[model samples]
Structures are given as C-alpha cells and as structure tokens.
Target: MTSPLNTLPALEKTLQEVEILLAEAEGFDEDRKKLVVLNKAAFLLLVGKFEAYIENLVEEFVFAINSLELRAAHVPERLLAEHSVQIVKNVKDHLNNGKLEKVNSMFIDLSRYWAEIEPCNSLNISNKFSYGKHGEKELIKMFKRCGIESIFDEIVLYDPQEKYDSNEDSVLDIKGIFNSITNMRNNILHQDETPTLTVGNVKYYKNILVQLAECLEELLQKIISNADSKRQKEGMFDYVI
Candidate 1:
C-alpha cells in the first residue's frame, strides 16, 4: 500500500500488477477462457481500481484538511462558501419531501449549523450525486468541491517538458481518455455482453490511468497549499495564557 499522501505511487503499483497479469495470460494461450477472464474480471477490476484511486485520494485529501483541526474561519473562503451550499442542500432536502414544514425553526437551525460548522469533509462533496458516472465532468466537479476549479483545463496547460508520458510529446486528451475508459467500463458492467478486450487493450487502459494519475498527483498539490495557507498560524498569540 502506498501512503495516502502519495496517490500516484499507489495507483501505479496496482496498474503495474495488472499489466503483469495480462502479460502472463499470454503464455497460456491454449486456454481460451483466460481471454474471457481478462475481458470481464481484469477489465472490471481495472475500472474499479481507477475509481477507487479517485475517490480515495479525494477522501484522504478532505480528511487531511479536517485532521488539521482548522476552524471554519481558517479555511479557504471559496471552499467554505462552496460547502455552505451543501448546508443549504441539507436543509432543503428534508423540507421538499412532499410535506409541509415550518419556516421559522428551519431558519434557526440553518443559522446554528452555519455558526458551528467545521471544515467540510467527503460527505459534503458526495451529496446529491445519484449515479456515479465517474466521467470527466464528474471527476472535475469533484475537485471543484474542494475549490480547485477547472482541473482539466489546468491539465491542458501542462508543460510539454514535464509530460506524463516521457516518450510521447502529444497533448493529453484528458476528457477523451476518461470518456473512453468510462464508456468501456460502463458497457461491460451495465450490459450482459462479454466485451472484446485484449492484453493490449488492458495495457492501453492501464497506461492511460497511469498517465491520469500523474496529472492528478501534480495538480493535487494545490490542495495542500489550500490547507496550509488557510491555517491560522498566529492564533496562539491571541491566547490569554
């Protein structure tokens, strides 16, 4: 297991294993069922791992922010403001459930929660997402929940010199990569068809995920900066010791 702080390495480790398995499967070409296994099982596992990587990293990031014990006042203004919308959603959800509600008490409750709120966590980010598409838009939206706006847009501006794939100089089509991977994975899971996947196909998807993880690892540093910058470093000076 890789440290939660270093998501890229953890992601790479799993992908490397998957690649090795695919490579080994080639040696047993006499067994046709091995191809089916790779098509269904290994492919599904690959998608699951990528989704887990995204969710786990995001969850760990929120936990890291909260574990610092920073008060709401010490948090980034944009992040706090975004989370306040979640509070509103929480209040609205119970009221509009085809039942009449009291306006005055709800107002008081909202004010109270706002006044007593701590740093927002994963729950705040997960609200109202009925289906987990895990597509490019959804993933970018997840990062927005943490105040990192337009993440893929930032990825587009990646320096060619610091490429995720050193052997390739072409720009990364982040959206296309995600769209392809999710489309294939969703087709396999949501449908009954035994999708045609090859050792090369598995390797292809694995490599794409590896590249994406590199992008995420580099961009996610902004989260640490957000946490550190918003910390109330001089608060102890105001103590009455």
Candidate 2:
C-alpha cells in the first residue's frame, strides 16, 4: 500500500544511507562486518533518524487535522487533553521548585488556552513533545495522547527476510525493539567500551525502524481522513435531527 505520509520516504532514504554506510564498512563484501566505528555510526544514525521520523510524523498529523476545521467535540477527547499536556507539566515543575510566580502565570496561560480555543478552529498542539529519550514507552504514550490506543497492537510489521515463519510470530520482537535500540545507542555513545557492531544487525535494525514508520503512517492517515470527513460547509456539527 502506498503511504500518504511525507516523512516515510525521507525516512526510507535515511535507512538506505545506514545500509550504504554498513556496506562500505564491510568493504562491499557480505563476508564480514569490518570497521567497528563505522558500524557504530550506522547504528547511531539509524536511531537518530528514526526518532526524528516519529516526531515529524506526529507534527504532520497535528497540522493535517488542524487544517480540516472539524468541531472540537468531534475530535478525540484524549487528543484535546493532549493539547494541555505541556502546560500541565510546566505547572507541576514550577510548583515543585517553589516558583509560585511562574506557577501562577502558567495557570493564567492555561485559562487563556481554554477560553480562547474555538470548537471549529485549530487544535493548540503542545510543542514540548517528550520523545527525546526514545523507547516503546515514549512512543506508546505519545500516540495514546493523540487518541491511538494500544498502538503496538494497531501496527503490523513484517520481517524483511524470509527467515521468520510469519510476521505475526516475528523473532525481531517489534514491540520490544525500539527500547532495545535506544538503550544500545546510549551505551555506545556514553560508555567507553565498544559495543558489538555488525552489518547484519545494522540492516536488521534499519528494517525494523522502517517497518514501524510505515505502519505508523498508515495509522495516522486513517485518523486524519476520519477527522476530515467530519467537516462540512459550516465546519461544525449542528446535531441535526
């Protein structure tokens, strides 16, 4: 199926680059993965680009839904709640620090956000998306706020190799892979010891990210299309009898 997502193609290109790096590291031979640092670079690039793809995909979804001019009542309740997540976090942080002045100001801003938001206007999407420490938990939480429940279940991933019996019984472990990759990248970046690096692993991880993004794109497209369907000439629901 062709994806409507703008970011998926670019993400595919990044994964291709990771494969290119891996091939070069192996001296264009599949016999063995050589050059440990280059292989590590491939892994890091995969992790960084994968993270960016998820973030940009969310931003894309928000902007697409905003353009539809759908009534807020028609928008998913969790999505509306998501719009205030950042402000609420700020309020908590300020109160924790004993910054009463900042806390009061945040409350004022919160009130304004509630008062000024029009039912048929654009959603006030929060800018402070906290997927920086990328993992399964971060991805699931972010998607849940956007009204996607049990996102991992919603995604269907396939193994690139004919090696696995079925995608449903994937050995790659789709749900667990994101956190594993992020943790491995952190160890490689922060710790002094060199982590195990191989061309096969690099390519395997790249395919995993690509498959995840592809499924995510399909999921978001469906959501945005549904939102667009709710809009009419008046751009708000009239509750017609």
Lowest lDDT sum, 10 consecutive residues, model 1, at: 232-241
TM-score of 2: 0.75
* Candidate 1: tens digits of C-alpha lDDT, residues 1-241: 1123677777877766676667767776788887677656767788788877888777666666655555555555555666657656666666776433554555554454345443333224452223755687888777777667877777752323344754445666768877877787777777766667877777667776767776776666566655566554434222211
Q: Which stretches of candidate 1 lie over 4 Å from their true place?
A: 1-4, 13-24, 69-74, 92-124, 127-132, 156-169, 194-196, 230-241
| Lowest-sum lDDT 10-residue window in model 2 | 232-241
Best by TM-score: 2
**What's the CA RMSD for each of the models?**
5.5, 5.3
TM-score of each: 0.69, 0.75
Clashing pairs in 1: none
